[model samples]
Target: MSNHEDDVVSALKRGADGYLLKDMEPEDLLKALHQAAAGQMVLSETLTPILAASLRENRPSADRDIQQLTPRERDILKLIAQGLPNKLIARRLTITESTVKVHVKHLLKKMKLKSRVEAAVWVLQGKNG
Candidate 1:
């Protein structure tokens, strides 16, 4: 029965993995619980559109912004999006760890992102356009 968007968002931020309405069917609740237990985020159907709209509204201009990245920067970003640490990324790319850090710093600055997690989420969300 909860309809407050802020409440739902707050619960999610506090590590609530699933957000189902009280009125959902028993079978649906069971299904959601199973999904959540499997490490999936389960939002009630009614909340999906709201979340989609929020994502769209907050999404950056990734097409143009991504174009600003150098080829090497883009490679590093793709690896970062894969959840690789700087050291692993450096080893994979055959670059020094310090060089990887420099590239990450410059790319984050150019993309107006503050952290590797944000970069990973941005790319995983297909915000690269």
Candidate 2:
């Protein structure tokens, strides 16, 4: 799997043979997919921190102002980290575009981020922190 987002991870856990990110250059993504189809583990440097950070403590920080998101929201957060468009997230989540917007708004508020890019960065950083 090669995507740097949760949807890809979910897909992988659900049995995807390959998972290239939308951000990857077409040539590289094609190469990675080819490698995956060849039975090789195709990965990228962007994935290193995520793999490393999956080991974080699970306890919630009561002192923080960040809202505790629902499991569904967390899933959305993962998609955001992948830099997916709201329409794409809606398609993946099987929700309406308006609903995805609401989730994005909620995520921005909960994470105290001013932009989706910031939230994406935070999600990546949180994984490795």
Candidate 3:
């Protein structure tokens, strides 16, 4: 039912496995449900291009802008890309959560990214290099 584009993007960023507009016909909705149950991502027709554009825009070029990151920052970025929460990342790195937050903030700024989800996509898609 949500028509807000930002809401749709945010939901996906937060790990929503499927997204469908409320206006979708019943048959399409059922098909989407089945697709979701089968471990496929489902998106409304209108949303597909939006998601694609977001991913394309967020993807980095081959210059390895990650070179701007320190070794530790790179490590934190990798964990963030893996979808680790700040607390868990801190525990894994033996650093304080606050410190992890600081690193995340710095890395996000350094990479010119708006959120951890973008960073995750970049890393997972091998765009960080």
Candidate 4:
């Protein structure tokens, strides 16, 4: 709704459900609210193009790829992409939590990504191959 790149990016990164403008009709706002309550993501129609462009701009350059990850680091990256926290990843992988953290740190560095969120997005974008 604000159509500001920084605000849109920040809200999405922080897990905002929807970013509707205040200028929308009351009925539309109510519909968005109900859609959110029903567990759907509600982004304003106007935001899609900008949001897509922002995502593209933040990604690692073409030469920097996920292929640099070690085999174990790749496993951890996949788990991170699945939204599993370190503790759960450790449990699922039969490793220590600290070990998982170490792998995560390594994987993030190798992928040239900043956070688990970025890694997850990268994976979802089919960049993990």
Candidate 5:
């Protein structure tokens, strides 16, 4: 039940581990809670970019306008670059096979890539282009 962006930003900046609307499904909320308790921060996916943008605002050069990627997406891209299949990437990332497909879709869109091979090439090119 927190919508004040500044307050939300502050909590995140202070390293609060979990942020979710009260209306989230019980299963999803529990998952986030577990992740937080494990000392890993769990942010609402919608809030991720806000956090990224705020950090970028504070450190412009270091941020460099790079496409903000979820940790999963980054991991998938690395494996894709390494020529792994979706099933294998799923196993490595510890996510369901279907979730891996979703990550692949988002990665392709975010990276402006058309296929896994294109993504692999982009990574191989050191993400310069």
Candidate 6:
């Protein structure tokens, strides 16, 4: 629904609590709804294999994505995880703030994340290798 490359991927990015197909079994749909209402992340059982295959074929895993970062980008990512602003990161890295901004943009794109917070959280969650 939001601006995204794909609907399923977009939904996941937007923090959808659950993903269910229209053709789901009535009982399973109800159960998924209940689980989501209880603050659980739910995915349709049938969708698991298909989603996994699609992700494996289409998108890099988090570690793979992190491995794709340039050294400068990785440094910036660590700075971001430390909650440093671009100016501070630039000063610490002895790069222009604009250059820091550019690196941030590239890193976000490489990680397929939307914003600095997401990038920070991703790194904090130990995917920043």
RMSD of each: 7.2, 11.2, 7.1, 6.1, 11.6, 10.3
Question: Model 5: how far is 21 from its true place, Å?
Answer: 53
Candidate 4: list runs displaced more than 4 Å. 1-4, 8-52
Q: In angstroms, how far off is 5's CA in candidate 1?
A: 10
Q: List the residue pairs that clash in candidate 5.
A: none
lDDT agreement of model 2 with the native: 0.60
- The candidate maximizing TM-score is 4
Clashing pairs in 3: none
TM for candidate 2 is: 0.48
RMSD of model 4 against the true structure: 6.1
Candidate 4 TM-score over all chains jointly: 0.62
TM-score computed on alpha carbons, candidate 5: 0.47
Q: In candidate 4, how many Å is residue 125 off?
A: 0.6
Cα lDDT listed for each candidate: 0.72, 0.60, 0.74, 0.72, 0.63, 0.68
Tens-digit per-residue lDDT, 43-126, candidate 6: 565554544444556645544467788999999988877667677888899999999989988988878865564565556555
TM-score of 1: 0.56
Instruction: Please give each candidate's TM-score.
Output: 0.56, 0.48, 0.61, 0.62, 0.47, 0.52
Q: Ten-residue segment with the worst summed lDDT in candidate 3?
A: 55-64
**Model 1 residue 36 lDDT score:** 60
Question: How many Å off is the CA of 61 in candidate 6?
Answer: 4.2
Between candidates 3 and 6, the one scoring higher on lDDT is: 3
lDDT (C-alpha) at residue 20 in model 5: 80
Which of candidates 2 and 6 reaches a greater lDDT?
Answer: 6
Please write out the lDDT profile of model 2 over residues 17-103, one tens digit for every residue.
Answer: 334566888899888777656444455557645533432332232322334776677888888777566777888999998998898
User: For model 5, how does the per-residue alpha-carbon lDDT over 1-129 read when each residue is reduced to its tens digit?
Assistant: 675567666765454434687777899889978865644345566765565455445433332222577777888888877756677778888898799889988876765555554455456555422
Off by over 4 Å in 3: 1-7, 10-52, 58-64
